[model samples]
Target: MELDDLIGIARARWRIIVAVFLSALALASAYVFLTPAQYKSTATVFLSINLDQNNLSSGSYALSQNVASYASLVTTDLVAKQVAADLPDLNLSPQALVGKLSSQVQQGTTFVDVSAQDHDPVKAQRIAQAAADEFRKEVQSLQTGLHAAATDAASLPIKPTSPKTTLDLLVAAIIGLLLGIAGAAIRDRLDKTIRTDKQVESATGAAVLAKVIHDSQASTKPLLTDIGEFASRAEAFRLLRTNLQFVDLDHPPRVFVVTSSVPAEGKTQTATNLAISMAKAGHRTLLVDGDLRRPTAAGLLGLDSSVGLTTVLTGQIDLSKAIQVHPESGLHLLAAGKRPPNPTEVLQTQATRDLIGALREAYDAVIIDAPPLLPVADPAVLASAADGAILVTRHGATTAAQLEVAAARLHSVGARIFGSVVNMVPRPDPGAYAYYMEYAPVANKQ
Candidate 1:
């Protein structure tokens, strides 16, 4: 990926990265604390060939070649056994002691370095010294004209060689940070939910008319009366009203269907609020709960839903008598009335089309709150009758695939797709929200 792509992923998924990093750091710290500390010490052994007066140059060359071979003998079982016997108080076996022993020839010299590691510094030094001594004795026994002797005694180590706190923590931190970035990149790749206005526009091939900020009080008070006009939620609806009017200049949509791909995506809420915002703007708006399968607009606005749309469609009540005006916002409401068994069949009839036509002539704007598009054919039918469909999708709740499917369903019926509404968007920062609220009233007056 390009640098810009990675940067975007980091910005969007920083929390996941931070969480993974902290977890890895914690694990590394636990390992450092629980693992035993190890101390290391080394002794140097010098190897030289016994030179005859006649062959001084040949003896020196032989010693240089044999120096590496002598270093290898330091790790032998014979050397470990001797060291173990010498340090019997430490209770290390020959096999176990061999694991702690190492040797290497010093470059450009006839010096063999023998090292040993142990939890205790004294033991490490004793083992290194004994291993050097034992290696020298083993070389003498070979009688190959080579002589070996300890040149430097092993020094006592005051600090541990393993579990270097600062270095270990630094390495751990780097590794943890890398893992966290990888995890965040993977998560961002896998997530398919709709999160931004751009994604909605791309998927639905329509502009995002509005982004409704999430409100905790919306469930108890669904209407704008409960949420003041100066609030962000009300401001969002106001923006929706303004955008809807400007979507089509010459032939603007006077009536439209508000629906989503699936239930609980806030389609009902969007329909209710948009109608109130339009009515508050002095437009004679009518909100019809066209979701005969499940009606909620009347209940949301505290209006009588017992005799409305279905009653008028069945010819049981006059259209004007069935429509109720919300006292608070002056928005006309036509409830779903008694749910019919055949909702799809009821909405597909000519009566439904005629009702939409009649409402379009009577009101400045008519918003029909329809059921989810995927589960039933009610919304597609309603959209076909109305001017267009305003698909309402919840932020992070509706997947791209679901939104695409809903848009395709609307397109199949040749329904006009005006635009989309993104619901329950994350609230802006507190300072920004307060600033907007403080100045919104003055902006409205202007």
Candidate 2:
């Protein structure tokens, strides 16, 4: 991924990253404080050769070869047993003493260092010193021409060495940061929710008309009829209405089926508000409740659903007698009336198509609030009878795959997708809208 993509993922999942990092640091802290402390002490032995001045160089080379062998003697069973006997207060067996002891030959020198580590500082020093003495005696017995002596006696260690606090914490911090970033990348890869306008446009190959900001009061008051003209929600619907006109300047769509990929994605609310917005702009608008499976548009506008589209289609009443008017927005409404047992079969009738044709001539704009496309075939059938469809998708809820399928279903029936609307976005930064509203016309502000 590019730098910008990484930055975006980090910004989106920072909480998860921070939580993982802090948990790692906490675990490291617990380990550092709970572990037992160990003190280390070291003792050095030097080897010298008894040689004549004529053979000085050969003697030095011989001593260097023997240095490594002497260092190995420090960890032998005999040396460990001897050291255990000398440090009786330590109460350690020969095997335990060998585990505590280590030896290394100084590079380019005939010298060896024996070290021991233990919880008791004084015992550590005694073990090192005893091991060095035993190694020295063993070297003397091996070669009479060589002399081995204790060069530096072990000293008492003042501090513990096992718990290196600073280094351990730094390593933990680096590992934690790397794990956090990897986790965030994995999460981003797995997420399939549609979030931005660009994603919807790319998936459906249609322009985004508007983004409706999330409102807590939207569930109770969904229509722009009750909201003021200057409110942000009303302004969003106005932007949608204006964009609809630009989709095709030559022959703009007069009747549109507003639906989504699934239920509760604000399709019903979008249809009602779009009709109100058109009426507010001095156009004759009519909102038809085309969803026979679950009708809600009539109740949303406080109208009577007892006599509507179904009543007119069944020859029980005329269209003029069944249509109700929303008092607040002056928009015409055609409720679904009573739901039928077979809604798909009902929407496919010739009468329904003729009603849509007649309504087109009676009104300047018409919005049909239809059921979700994926769950039922009602929206696709209605779109085939209407001019086009306007897909409504909820932010962080609808997946790109579902939107693609919905668009494909419409296209299969020769229905055009006018555009899409991204609904329930988080409120914008106040400064962003303030700058645009500053240049708004005076009449719009009122």
Candidate 3:
């Protein structure tokens, strides 16, 4: 990976990296404390030929050839077994204790180095000394007059050799760092959600009209622009309103349908807030409950919905008289009067088309809160009559496939899609706006 890629992974997954590293370090520390301390000791022995002055050169040549053989015998099972027998108090089997004994010698030298390791320093020292003594006795039994004596005896070591706590911890940290990098890369690959302005444009092939920050009080106060001043959310809707006016310079979209791929993607909320924002901005905005099956616009505005769109469509009441006005926000609402059977048939009628056309001419901007596209053909049918459609999607809650499907459904029928509005996206910090490509690589100096 390049330096930037590694930095990005570490930045995105730093928490996992730190947690794993600390966990490994903690385990290493525990092992150091709980495990018995191991100490190592080595006993040096020097050997030479017992040669007469007349034949010293010949005897030395023979002794040089025998040094390697003697060194090899020092750690053999034969010698190790004897050493084990001498340290019976340690209770180690000959085979189990065999690996701890080892011997080394220099080429053409009359010396052997015997080393031993044990949990107790004193035991290690005793084993090293005893192994050398036994090897000397074996040499004597062979009737070889070669001299052997302890040059430097094993001493008690003050420290342990097995745990190597610092080195082990360093190795563990490296392992943890690798694991974190793998996890971050896998997570980034597996995730298929569209989260950035770039991703939305790439996936839906449409410009973003607005990015509405998530608000906890939106459910209660859905009309963000009803207040006098525009907060961040209100300002965002105002921005959306301004963008809608410029969608077509010759003729802007007066009547538009607000719908999404599936329900609870904040389509209704977007419709209500956009209508209110437009009305508050001195536009005669009318919000119609196009979704007859599930009417939410009326409930959101706290208006009486006993008689509205369906009541007027069926000629039960005049459309003009059925329209209610919100005294606070100056917005108009035409609620879905009653749930009618065969909603698609009712919405597909030419009369429904004519009524929307008439409403479009009556108001400056008309926003219809239509049903979700994939669940039914109602939103598509309604979208056909409207001048344009505003696709609404929630951050992470809506997938790229769903947005594509919704766009394709609208496009198939030759409907005009104005743009998309990303709703309920996380609010950015003072210096943060990373919702879409929310992850950034941290700069790391090597």
How do all models score by TM-score? 0.91, 0.82, 0.77
> Which residue pairs in model 3 clash with each other?
8-441, 195-436, 196-436, 434-438
Write the residue-wise lDDT of candidate 2 on 1-446 in tens digits.
99998887787678778988898889889988998889999999998988889887898888898788878988889999999888888789999999999999989988889999998899899899999899888888887678988889999999899788888888888888889988998988898888777889987889999899898888777788776666778889989999999988998789999999999899999999999999989999999999998899999999998888888999999899998999888999999988889999989999999999999999999999999999999999999999999999999889999999999999999999999999988776688778666756665558
lDDT per residue for candidate 3 within 126-154, as digits (tens), equals 88888888877776565466778778887
- Model 3 lowest lDDT segment of ten: 436-445
What local distance difference test score does each model get?
A: 0.90, 0.90, 0.82
Worst 10 residues of 1 by lDDT: 221-230
Model 3 earns a TM-score of 0.77
lDDT per residue (tens digit) for residues 1-446 in model 1 = 99988887787778888898888788879878988999999999888777678897978987787778778888889888888888889899999999999999999999889999999899899899999889999988886777887889999999898888778888988988898889988988898999877789998999999998889988887778887768788888888889888888999889989999999999998999899889988999999999888898888888888999999999999998999999988999999999899999999999999999999999999999999999998899999999999999999789999999999999999998889999888775689888887887788799
Candidate 1 clashing pairs, residues 3+ apart or interchain: none
Q: Any idea what lDDT model 3 has?
A: 0.82
Ranking by lDDT: 2, 1, 3
